[model samples]
Target: MILLRLTWLSLLNRKATLLLILASISISVFLLLAVDMVRHQVKDSFSSTVSGTDLVVGARSGQINLLLYSVFRIGNATNNISWQSYQEISKHPKVDWSIPLSLGDSHKGYRVLGTSQTYFTHYRYGKKQNLDFAKGKPFAGLFDVVLGAEVAKALNYKLGDSIVIAHGMGNAALVEHGDKPFVVSGILKPTGTPVDRTLHVSLEAIEAIHVDWKAGTKIPGLNISAEQALGMDLKPKQITAFMLGLKSRLSVFHLQRSINNYRSEPLQAILPGLALQELWQMFSLAEKALMFVSALVALSSFIGLLALMLTSLNERRREMAILRSVGARPMHILLLLVIESSLLTCLSVLFGVALLYLSLGTLSPWIQSEWGFRLIVQPLTLWQWQLLGILMLAGSCVGVIPGIRAYKQSLIDGMAIRL
Candidate 1:
């Protein structure tokens, strides 16, 4: 108890410098933990968005492009699959369920996904699962809207509210769908995928809104009422892509090959898991860059802590003389310094974690609203915890230099050392 109090007093005496050290270490720990968590999660998020699905089939493109456009809503699809091709694949014997998707538009920066009700009933993310509705029911009729959890919360949308859709694949200058508006039919539970930020409506809704348009612009002076739209056949001509689940997992490669060599128009089929792996490989470079940058920041912080303690040691020489005369051993003095530093490091790590979670909890709604990215404050994984422990140990070890110097100075000066 006496020794612990001595260590406490020593750090308390230099409160200003110690506080700076604490702040630096805290920022470093926070950044290290945050970067590690984000790198793992972004990849996990991308891969988890569509699991248990055998393949994602779309018009001819690279595997990475197909996955990004269909699953992540990252980029627009270069070509769309005809509705006839979707039906033909659905008829295959090994197929269990197929969800067709129509893309190529946005509303206030939110992705507009035109899909059948099976998307809510059968589509899964993270694990093999179905869409969970947080409020209201799924789309029931043409022009009905189903907001993602993020979309609903961010936009403050609820059931029966009306909203206008925008034209084009991005934040465009004009409101093309202003002539036609949609009623909020439902809001989905949070799934933490692109789905959470997407706006889901029926394929018929896609057809109805786009019937008179060509090449992403309205055919001039060609306007029709919602009633007239309802009267026309609402079938889709071209869909951006489709997801396929197989009755037999073993037949995935065979199905992929079949789709790749379709009779008339060329098509490409990508295994969701395989395509996800490819996508991750492409993104790994960015992850490495972030990790490297965060590591350098941590290194600088630890060095700052070391420099502060060493510089402050000069003022403590007389204090050390007093302690040596009072019968404190060299090891005891060394341990006092180590305990102070280790405790400070541990506190910084804990405080940093708290601050990170607090920030995320507060800003999560805003981030999802504007960025279409969900930030999850998950506890450190085992490996991540281990990495942090190693950093803490390294920081503490670096702190030992001051303790060693203090021990030597106390022994050599024999109660006469003066700063």
Candidate 2:
């Protein structure tokens, strides 16, 4: 109890230097905790991007490629599946429901997905959570569109607003479908996935926009009005990809195999869960790299604490003489230094934890709005508690160096000071 009181008083005496060291250690702790939290949250977000869909079927291509374009909206499809092929497989005995996706257009910088109303009913994300509207209802008209939360917020769009989609997948497109403008019929609530960044439209709307175009360009002297195009057939001939929910979990593999071996068209079907696992494997190295960097930061802060103690020891020689004159033993001085170091570490950890939660509370909403994923405020995980324990042990070990120095110096400089 005496040593602890003395340590606290000593730390308070050198407030400036000690506070600086405290800030450094606290910052390191914050980085370590933040990295772990983000890694897990990002993995959860990726895994739950689309749920309840057993298989994602697309034209013959790499599983990663199909998953990327179909679910993540990351890349363009290599080939589109014929509409006939979709119908044939969707009617399979095991298939319960299907959501067809037609990509290849953009509104501003966000991807425009052409899908059926079945998409709104069948698509699931984040533990089978259904899509909900933040503003209005789903599109009913051929020229109606529904905006994702991010798209609406970023573009400041509201219900009944008109927007034109551009050909291809970029913000800067040479051709715009200006003739057929779409009204904002709805805006979906944020799902913390790529769904938040997409604009939804009917599959027929995709075909209607290109009715007068041939070979990716509008035919010369052939301009089709939106009304005239609406009267013509708008059934999609092909689609980028489709997702399927099976009637039973047991039939998922069997149906996937059947679709992959379909004789009419070359197609590939992937289990969304397995494909997501593979995607995470590719990014595991990057996650480890981040953890490594955070560990180094923490290590450097401990090194700084060691240096502070060692440098302060010399100035405390007179103080040590006073204690020895009062019959203090070398072991007491050693234990004092250890207790002081432990106190510093504990206080730094407390400050770090407080800062971390404060920052999360302040920035969580902004992060969700900007990045589309909620920064979940959860209790420190067991692994995180273990990490804190390790940090405390490391800090205590660092004190041993200065403790040994003080122990040896007390013997030689008993009741005498060279200065």
Best by lDDT: 2
- Tell me the lDDT of model 2 at 14: 92
Q: Per-prediction TM-score, please?
A: 0.93, 0.94
**Candidate 2, pairs of clashing residues:** none
Worst 10 residues of 2 by lDDT: 167-176
What is the TM-score (0 to 1) of candidate 2?
Answer: 0.94
Query: Which candidate has the highest TM-score of all?
Result: 2
Q: How well does candidate 1 match the true structure, expressed as C-alpha RMSD? A: 2.1
**Which regions of candidate 2 deviate over 4 angstroms?**
362-371
Clashes of each: 0, 0
lDDT for each residue of candidate 1 in 78-126, tens digit (9 for 90 to 100): 7888899899998899999999999877777888999997887778887
What's the distance in Å from true for residue 239, model 1?
1.0
lDDT of 2 by residue, 64-146 (tens): 98999999898888888999999999999899999999998898878999999999999999989999999999999999999
